[model samples]
Target: MNWQDEAMRYEPLKAQDLYDFATAEQKQEAVEAYNRAVNKLRSGNGDVAGIALRQLAAQYPDFAEAGLLSVCCQMLWGDRRGALQILQRFSQAGYLTEDESFKTERYLAAVSSEPARETEDPGAVVVMDGENLRRDTVKPPRLLRRASADSGVEVASASEQEAFLREHNLNLKKHHYVASRSSNLLIKWLVTLLIILLLIALLLVVFLLLPQGGKTGAAATASPGLLNWSGLRLWRPVNLFQA
Candidate 1:
């Protein structure tokens, strides 16, 4: 049967029910493990805490506290779907119920009240043992300062948070695109200029060589005396007959 069906088959177990089933040594171990996980979570080590909690829940399936705290860690890590699945699993295991206090926890309640959307804001604060444990909010770009969580101040709404992230991403992409296009255009212009300069240099070389060729042709035509000196001279026979 599916988890929902399975969950419906058995009545939910409370903390006392879980304790009743555990051995004395297992109970002591569970309590110690739960405390360590809580300490890790309070110290902002949610990743380690989450793993520990999951292991604790697995080792002692009846430990309701471990399961509930695991949900908290999932929410803290921005894993809403994961958190919900853990709750479902716990429900199926009889450690959680529809009327359990886990549902009323601030993180779950906030996410549950809203429709699932890309823009939904997972809350920045976690409630544990009737205490508000504030998480560090991400700092947005300078342009989105109005929506940022400054000095523990919460954002006005989820919509503003979504807008801030969207605008920041758009601006980053736009900057990269503009920079790339500009570099391409600059390269094209430089190449075109270099080609133009090369052509001009070629024309200048051709022009410079043309004058030297013309001078050589003129010198060859004007030096006919040199060719005549190397051959037979002109004769003066008519002058001898007159004498």
Candidate 2:
């Protein structure tokens, strides 16, 4: 059942709702239920409120207040000792304290004198009482690290743990921004190196494909005076021997 919603809907089931003549016990029980509901809300546990609501409505439908709050405690639970104590007390109580109709002394005397008859259903009879109920609020705790059952890990006690939670509460958990900047720098340097190597490779290919030739602009044409020594007998090839 949606107990948390019900608890909030009828937040303070007034003392008058019980029987018109409100007693201190009735007032206190309403206050107690309201406070515990608030505690369960803060602790983020709806199950506790549900259990309490079921028991309270069953025991004292008129009182609309006192109840038990029990939880398995394996799930996401917080530290709420006051709420737990209220549940424990309800679990072990005798009948409803405010219910003047229930005489506990007479009931116990009858039980002791005679045992249950044959075919009598064997179920626990819940006896509700809230005389010792008190409301207490729980303060929020820090990040709690859970250990793996398979791994070799030692669970730390409350005394062993430090008062302040370390880096777990820090706003910036990692330096991802810095790492990204460094990666960008490495990529830029790699591209620059590749460009330089490509340019060097192009220059080498051009040099290798160039035509090889002997040195030029040094052999001058023979001067006319040097050739004139043989100019006096200059003649056609056919008449050069006779001349």
Candidate 3:
């Protein structure tokens, strides 16, 4: 049978079923690993977080949360095909339900609508015959409930989550370029304004000094012998007495 036919033969595995089969230590290890991956994601290291999450999901194939988070990381890192593949796996496993927030996740909206084979990654196509899908259904586990509360990852809506991821993925270099360019323009304008003010002050000083110098030169020309007071004043006082 083809992989698709094989995948169709088995019932989908639920999160609770996988949880039931896991040992306490295994559950503990999975939670710790998930926490570490979440920390990496929170610190804006999506690439590292993606790798960690993928590894965690691979190590614990039944950990639906790990697979889901890894899908988010893949989307954030621009790996649509990878994200789609994970989503397909979970969908086949019945991890994705009608009410799951992933149904409305914008990243998957386009991918879900199109044919999986059209993706550049051939592996993006679902492989249902894998051992990962060969599991029995069971009751839900407590770890799923407690992990949601303690993991520190916000259980916001899919849109909000996508917004959060986009916020982190913003092109910082573009922002820096715009900011630096704006600052340079502002500095140029300030310098130009300062140069204009200085020129105006210099012109005012020249104009004031020029008028004062002109008045001084005119007075000197009007009374060329003004410095020689002895030429007339002393003789006029003595002549008044003798006459």
Candidate 4:
């Protein structure tokens, strides 16, 4: 049978049947069936694939492949928290690959670092605390405003500090600036591919039109004087008749 027919034949195999298959031939058949389902999902029937994966997971809870497939479905469905929890559980169960663990840790760290709620920008507000009025920008307020000028401390160009606070909704946090080297290799590679495709398309067009172009060129280049000497007798008779 053809490959398309072969692929189409095993669409009915379930996850339980695959797990129970002990023989090499049976295992291969099961793998092929799962691959067919995965391909179908990738081709835009993700919801159907997801239901299949969920069924697979329910049938085989300890199956690593089923767990990973369920996680993938959750991510595609936009359930980030559900995916994260699954990843965490997989990591704890030692079922996650090294790359999966790394990605999970990175996601968790980034989520934990975000502020609980937005803070108001303290724009030169010198609130009094007890007997002291302090410049409110500093996290702990280094000097009390009572000992400084009325507008607040005589701090030079606190705009940078103020701007950082306003932007991040944080008070007096030190900022670090670092320039990263630009690596535009992907963009360059894409542009090169585009140029190659355009050149290929141009060559295809030229190849398609070559016969017509050759016919036109032959007609344009051909002249009465350019004909073979054997044809001179035919032309000579015509000229004699005209005379």
CA displacement after TM-score superposition, residue 37 of candidate 4 (Å): 2.2
Where model 1 places Cα greater than 4 Å from the true spot, the runs are 1-18, 89-111, 114-243
Question: Residue 125 of candidate 2: its Cα lDDT?
Answer: 18
Count backbone clashes in candidate 1: 0
- The lDDT of model 4 is 0.44
lDDT of 3 by residue, 114-164 (tens): 454434421211111211211112211001111232353222344433343
Top-lDDT structure, candidate number: 1
lDDT of 2 by residue, 98-207 (tens): 43223223323332344333432212111111212112222222222234435432333442222211111211111111122234566999999999999999998877
TM-score of 4: 0.30
CA lDDT, every model vs. true structure: 0.47, 0.35, 0.46, 0.44
Show how many residue pairs clash in every candidate, following the order shown: 0, 0, 0, 1
* 68-89 per-residue lDDT for model 4 (tens digits): 5555555444444544555555
- Which ten contiguous residues of candidate 4 have the minimum total lDDT? 174-183
Any residue pairs clashing in model 4, and if so which?
Answer: 133-145
Candidate 2 lDDT score at position 112: 35
Per-residue error for 8 in candidate 4, Å, reads: 20
The TM-scores, one per candidate, come to: 0.35, 0.22, 0.36, 0.30
lDDT of 2: 0.35
